[model samples]
Target: MYTEHPGSCSTTGAIGLERTRFFPRQLITPDDLIQDQIYFRDKLRRHNRLLHGWGVVCGARIKPGTGECEIVIEPGYILGPYGDEIYIDQEVTVNLCQQGTDGNAISPCSDMTDPWCSNIRVDRQSNKPYYLAVRYAECQTRPVRVVGTSCGCNEIECEYSRIRDSYAIKLLSELPSTYADPMPQPNLDDVARCTPDHACPACPTEPWVILADITLGAGSKVTKEGIDCFAHRRHVVSFANYYYLCKSTTLPVVRSIFPGNGINLNNDQALLREWAQRPLLKITFDREMAMPKLSEPDAWLRFWQLRSDDNLTVVRRIFLALSPENPPATDESGFTATYQLRAGAQELFQSRFLIQIRATADTITDTTTPPNLLDADFSGTKLSSEQLNQVWNVTDQTTLSIEILNNLSTTDATLPSGDRAAGGQFHSWFAVLG
Candidate 1:
């Protein structure tokens, strides 16, 4: 006999023997899988929301000033039994919440009356969350105003005007009530009735005076005879082979040199003869003819021409003239000239020196002579002044020394020969101009 049953299958063997086997039926459907997916997605969203709330709480605690709170959301994935390991990650949304010091919910509102209350919000384009911060201040009661007597009319008026211009009415209202009131309005009638005293300011008794003096040397005396004054006074000094006439007076004084005790020269005589008449001070030469002419029309012109023609050549001549045995001091192959200004303890306003040199070159050669012979190889380096006003503003008892460097490499060149060489001279003089 064969029997049939639900979820059971019967099979007969080839010899007519019977056997029964049972198979389980499938109960789950496609709808159930869909429901499972929804359930997991909702769970992940809830977890994300909880994390965002936590982030907001953390931000609010450390919020700076009056800034609001911020929140951030992150998305991720998880493995599951459904589909191909179910999608565990979902889109995350950030939410912001305002909380008070008591941990209770509060609105993000800034108080206008409170100067310290401030609100701020920040947004970022990256995955970083938005930030909010709030700063709060304790409220205070307004104080009563107190009026006080106002004096110093001018000063009070200035203060009132400044405060009114700078601060708004609302800010002014917040000031302490005890603050002084605005200055009283000016009295037009009283101002009109007052007498006007229009006297000019008092003038100074002695209007400042500038005195300029030029001195020759320690023992030498400065007299009106040696000075030629036009708009200013000119002092003459002799140093080495040259005579210098430096203007020693300021711009205001105008005294002619020839009228008073100035140098008297015969106009009919030769220019050279008149130059010889001028007294030589603080300088001496071996021979009379060695002194260059410094008389009339051409004397001044020749003086400047010698200096401007070739400064280096003139400097070498002057160096030899000062002391024939003392050629410029040598540093390796180069030469240098040193000069000392012996002011002693005298304090001077302005000091100037005029130097002159004259000599004939007996021997000249490209190799033996200095390169760029015409260039001013010797510069007034130590005591040199750039502008006119760069006066030697020295302290009391201080003496100034100057060094002149010679760029020539003619270490082998011998000094000039003949009477002129022995008699050659370099002259310099000092003058104070204030």
Candidate 2:
């Protein structure tokens, strides 16, 4: 038998297959047909795992139920780690909040959670966070036709004629460990299929689909503090949209960074054509956030720098603009003192720009505080510099920065802030320019 794999990563790569060649009057055994069926089945499983990827598509929300320790999992679609599709038409409720009261009862190491709570949770003495996940499952059933029922040779056909596709909802202490991309040693079946290197990574882990991290006290009701759904829950966009993006069929062309923020962009045909050619990546501060209310002036962030020619771009820092960019990319004094994207005259705001705050009333004597952003009124509605601390009626970080950045040029980002609260949390998305 011959087999092949694509790309450098063998485990993730697709496996090659072989078909039996039959001649007239050639005897075909049950093994030959079984192999034939497996080939097609493996083909589709690989497609889903490799190309489409895996994650919860929609509606696997964890919500508090009427019971003290119960949580409801709304009906949803999930793609398992091994590319198995799990569709729950109705809501599945897993009770993590309670367990049986029998003190002497020995609990199963793990309960088999499928077919909607077929087993009960075994209460552990201590209360800790349980990692909830789902994984693809299969079972052999539908026994039919005994051995030698028809054929006189007494050779058994297939013991189980059918395989059922199912899923399991499990509570895990940690993520299941990953195994070798493929099993090292080869058995008869492995030799035929798991060829080349003979290791398949997904075999061990069951490729769990993590639902949430939850904790429940002995008799406490489920509360917001116990369940953290967003921490581990991975979101998957619709397949059609993601597939289009994966192929790069349609490129995103953004005309302005601050389109609806009252900043008119330079939309000349020449510039528009130029922008169409270059890639644009941006972070939009959509939610309102206030500057950290603190007593010390030096504690606040001075200059939030944008990308420079010398700066090493870090994609992770897209949303955490308030935090410092590590190792200090550039010492170059920015061209603009204002909050403009570009430094030069032909500015369309595509360039990554720095965000500077008006830390103090005196921009010159208190140079460490940087300059006021937005309309030069970083401290809005405040009567005195002493009262410029975070208070009621203070504009959000975005609004306050606009006022100063609109007036002056950006400063050096050599100095950065460590405070997470200083920056507003916002969602970041990326698109490629054709």
Candidate 3:
């Protein structure tokens, strides 16, 4: 029954439940859970190994035009019972060229046109090292080995690609230890828990493990589905309703020109000046209620403003209008035409300083543009530049009455007929603006 701010009634604020409730799902589906488990288990192993003390870690950069963001290893790192092979187990690294505005690589990695395509080798037939492109199945997460045969007395039959003329091996200082004696492959699960610092007791030494760090840019776009997912998770603990103990919190202090709630305009300019510098306006509503919906036509706002000096008193009122049936050609500004400043005195203005048009509802068949807002109270008073200066000289204290008139074409539209039901799209606020 308690409410925080009287304005908490805004549409965006009214989302919590008043009580707890539960629902049952129709059937059970465990396929997704199983897949998630498998992916988590395998992915852990694929990135967890640190084999030959010299294996290379490959990943992509994802920074801005000059920054890197993605760093995924291809087939990750390799582990073998036999000592590393000279060139057979050699690890090659390449960068994936980002597509440019025209869809071509600005700086193509010619040596590895497509890591997604085939394995490229370094050609050392000449004094300088160069890479030669070869054909192979599209490279995925698995590494593919190529073999070639040598034909001569001096050359034993070699099973590998000679694209590099076998000269690239010279670039590597220490050769892969011989693995003629083999040990049983470790269980993939246990291997996942094994750290790179210690691949095995028998394996020569741990391989070089490369780790990449990246930061995402602020321009990243997020979809509504993503927000909904977060909300769904939060809802687990914030089940509908089941209200918590309500306590009043001190509201921000704000200065009010029209003093008191019932009927008092201590319209003293000196008093008003002191109130204005209080930083914030504090109002105690007594209790906390769910946040309110501002869009509700019956919803209205009221506040008072006093000059910084001890000389003026101004009261402000606000209202909302609906574009029912056929909307107006142009939206009306302000909420009412006639503002009853005092009982029996009604001033009609084409505009009200307080009324504002926000949005319009779609019409069934009317092609005319709808009136988004209709402000009326400010219509008549030509308080032009000079008239507004005509402050109500309060020689004697007087009670001021205010009534706002809503004259939009839709003011008479049909509304539900009960107090509990929504009233017509009309509301009123009154204050003694001294």
TM-score of each: 0.13, 0.39, 0.17
TM-score for candidate 1, please give it. Answer: 0.13
For each candidate in the order shown, give its overall lDDT on alpha carbons: 0.22, 0.42, 0.23
Order the numbered candidates by lDDT, best leading. Answer: 2, 3, 1
Q: Over 4 Å off in model 3, which ranges?
A: 1-167, 170-311, 327-434
Q: Write the per-residue lDDT of candidate 1 for residues 1-434, one digit (tens) a residue.
A: 01111110111111122222224774666444445444554454334333221111111111112222222212222211111111213232212233323221222121244455442222223222121211111222223233453443332332221101010000011112211133144465864575586332222121111111111212222223322211111111213355778633221100111111111223324532423333112221111121122111121111110111233212111111222233224343233222222322132222223333322231111122221111111111132333101211211222222222221111221222122121222222222232
lDDT per residue as tens, model 2, 25-95: 98989766666565666666677666665678888888877777677778888877666676766776666
lDDT of 2 at 299: 31
Q: RMSD in angstroms, all models? A: 41.3, 23.3, 27.6
Which structure among the candidates has the greatest lDDT?
A: 2
- After superposition, the stretches of candidate 1 with alpha carbons farther than 4 Å from their true spots are 1-283, 290-349, 361-434
What would the TM-score be for candidate 2 when compared with the true structure? Answer: 0.39
Which portions of model 2 miss their true places by more than 4 Å? 1-16, 20-22, 97-121, 124-127, 147-159, 177-206, 218-220, 240-434
* Model 3, span 1-434: residue lDDT tens: 11111111111222232222224863435443344443443333233322222222221111222222111222222221112211222323322223222221211212343357443332222222111111111111222242453343221442222222111111211222321112134365875575667534442332211122122223322112211111101011112346787443232111121222222222555644443332111211112211222223332322222222223233333222322332222213211111112211121111222222111231111111321121112211222222222222222222222211122112221211112211111121122244
Candidate 1: C-alpha RMSD to true structure equals 41.3
How far out, in Å, is residue 266 in model 3?
33
